[model samples]
Target: MELKLPEIPELSRQHRLAAQEQLDRKTKPVGSLGRLEELAVQLCAIQHKVPPDTARKRILVFAADHGITEEKVSAYPREVTAQMLANFAAGGAAINVLARLMGGELFVVDVGVAAEPVVGVKNRKVRWGTRNFAHEPAMTVEETLQALNVGIELAFEAAEDEVDILCLGEMGIGNTTAAAALLCLLTEAREEQVVGRGTGLTDAQLEHKRAIVARAVARHREWVKTPFEALCAVGGLEIAALVGSMIGAAASKIPVIVDGFIVTVAALVAYHLTPKARDALIFAHRSEELGHRYALELLEANPLLDLGMRLGEGSGAALASFLVEAAGRILREMATFAEAGVSEREEQDVT
Candidate 1:
């Protein structure tokens, strides 16, 4: 199936100028917030207003299964995916607690899971997970499109509700393996360059995992030509949904705060599909994963922080959102020197 991108909603010039004026008046010197001013500007574009107000924040934790788990590359078993989903719904998971503290709604969308999850457990199971890619393709092209549609719909709903920011998260065991493989195919990177120890793999196991991914790429070289093909060849359903969500956010003009390696890989594919979408991205932070740096370079995104975090679940991204919010607050609420009737520097006369 051909990938069809949605039409973008254009913002008026008056609204952008107004947002800029508001930013300049709030506190410090012009453009003092740095990229944060850019973030607020993009938010204004999405919201079609000046002085973007962050009234609602939403985090979408996409849950999916990875077929490559059959290779025993991951330390955790596949069942651990479903188990963590339960933990998330119960508010026992780390992300759940963080989300609660952050005062945002946490939503879990089940694009695919190997084991059928209970419907009432704060999960949306799309299918019983994807097939094993070690033996064959992870998913058919049709299924990939469906996953993208799900992400697009969810994002549009959030935009309609006036959500100013959306953080894309994921829950999938052995997913880093899939993310590395996908990154390799997209960037034409060798296995050794993009592969990393996901969730603490033994050295020997890491070598095994890398070799497996290398061989998988060689096997699907033909189908790995385009971004969609590469994703179908060795992509995680959650990653694909993230790609879709990024696209939807851009099409809607909302800002997306990206997390770790897996989520970054998805954003990479989304940018590949629509280069204009680049303007809507905010790199939340850098992960401890080996390949994350390479992926960030490929996207030309500098993360806001580097906390040595490898935990997926969008933890870093959620926390970084607060910083962006504070940046806005400081720009908009803090008193400026001129406003306080302070005199300018004597050097100003020389200039």
Candidate 2:
């Protein structure tokens, strides 16, 4: 199948200005809310609503297995991918807990888990798992396009459900290695600059993982000319799906909360594919992963939280959704100075 990327329209400047004006008139001092105020304006602009409806939040966790585990890159075994999907279905994972606490619905899609389909999870498996990229391309162009379509289908389903905001997450063992390779290729960063201890690899293991990423990139760099080709070269199924999800969400005009390093790598691909997708993305946090900083820098994104979080599965995004909702509520519910009958600052008192 030909992977035709959806066209994401640019966010409206008028809506941004209107939201900023409303925020300035709020009872609090101008910009006192800091990033929260900016988030409100962004939400308003994306949704074209004065206060942006954040009533329905959905977290989509794409699960897959990475054949790179054959390289011993991750501290966890490949079986953990399927195990985590079952855990998510059992409502025992960190994301499940956060989604429940934050009133956000959690859905898991088995894009390529290398196992039988787990009950209670959406089955959209493109393959058993991505091929090991250390010696070969991770996925064929057709498989990559199929994975992307799966994500696009899910995003449209969320739109059908009237979800106001979407959060992107993933559960794929050894995916960090895939993400690191893709990051190195996309950002032209050295292996050390983009490789990190995934699932707590020791210093020596981390070094070995870096070498593997270096080798993989060296093998594929010459032919990986475009973002799509880069994904096919070194990206995992879940990563490609997340890329599609961002594009589809942007096309649907629904803001997406991007999770950590792996998800951020997917965001980088989506941004390169369609720069306007950045307007529909809300970065959730800065992961402890070393490569996350490079991905964030590449996208010029300032995430909402930075509590040294590296746990994927949308945990960071789930926490950040509360802030997104709070920003919307602040714009919708907070009383303006005039409505509250409060005195404004003196015209000469700029400070």
Candidate 3:
């Protein structure tokens, strides 16, 4: 199947200027709120509204298993992917708690978990699991397109439901190895720069994981020219879904709060496919993963938080939603200097 991507429209510069003017008039000195002001402007530009809608947030967790776990790349067992889906359904996971606290509806999507159908999770499985990229391509081009379409469908559904924002995350064993391999391929970084100790791998295990990434990248480098080709080579099904979701959200004019490392890799692919998609992305936080900084730099993104978070279940995005909401509220609800009769900053005459 030929994959058809949606056309991602650029954010409105007119709305951006309007948002900035409003922020400057908000009684605080210009840019006093710093990144908050920048975020508000971006939100306005994406939505083409003076104040973007920041309510009705949705958190989508894409769960799958990577066959690369066979390489002993991660500390956790592969079955943990299915077990964690059950935990998510039971509201016992950290993301469950965080989503509830942040007033965001959480949905778990089973794209390619190795287990049977998981109860209470969306069954959109493209396959049982991706093939081990250490030996060959992780997914066929057709399977990759299927996984991407599943995410696009979900994101379109969110847009129809009037969801104001989408927060992306993933659950998969040995996915860090896949993400690291993708980072090296996408950003032209070395394995040592992109690989990290996923799930607390020991020093020796981390080195082994790095070696696996190097080998995988070396095996697939020539054919992995496009971002889609790179994804087909070594990306996880959930990661492919993430790339689709970002593109789908952009096409629907919805902003996405991107989570750490793994999701950032997805965003990188999305950006590569549709550079205008970056206009709708709000990076949530920096991860403790070694490659996250490099990925962020490649995307020219400055994340909203950096609390040493490596947990990739949208925890950081959930937390950052509060700040996103606050930024919107500041734009919409704050009294302007003239409205509040506040003295404006004096312009210093230098002539």
Winner by lDDT between candidate 3 and candidate 1:
3
Over 4 Å off, model 1:
9-21, 30-35, 45-48, 119-124, 335-347
Over the stretch 133-168, how does candidate 3's per-residue lDDT look in tens digits?
A: 999999999999999999999999999999998999
Model 1: how large is the Cα RMSD against the reference? Answer: 2.4
After superposing all C-alphas onto the true structure, candidate 3 shows an RMSD in angstroms of: 1.3
Q: How do the residues 22-132 of candidate 2 rate in per-residue lDDT, one tens digit apiece?
A: 999999889999989999999988987787899899999999998899999988899999998989999999998899899998999999999999999999999999999
Task: Give one digit per residue, the lDDT tens place, for model 1 in 160-200.
Answer: 98787888899999899899988888877998888899889
Considering only N, C-alpha and C atoms within 3 Å, which residue pairs clash in candidate 1?
A: 113-128, 113-129
lDDT of 3: 0.93
Off by over 4 Å in 3: 347-351
TM-scores for all predictions: 0.92, 0.97, 0.97
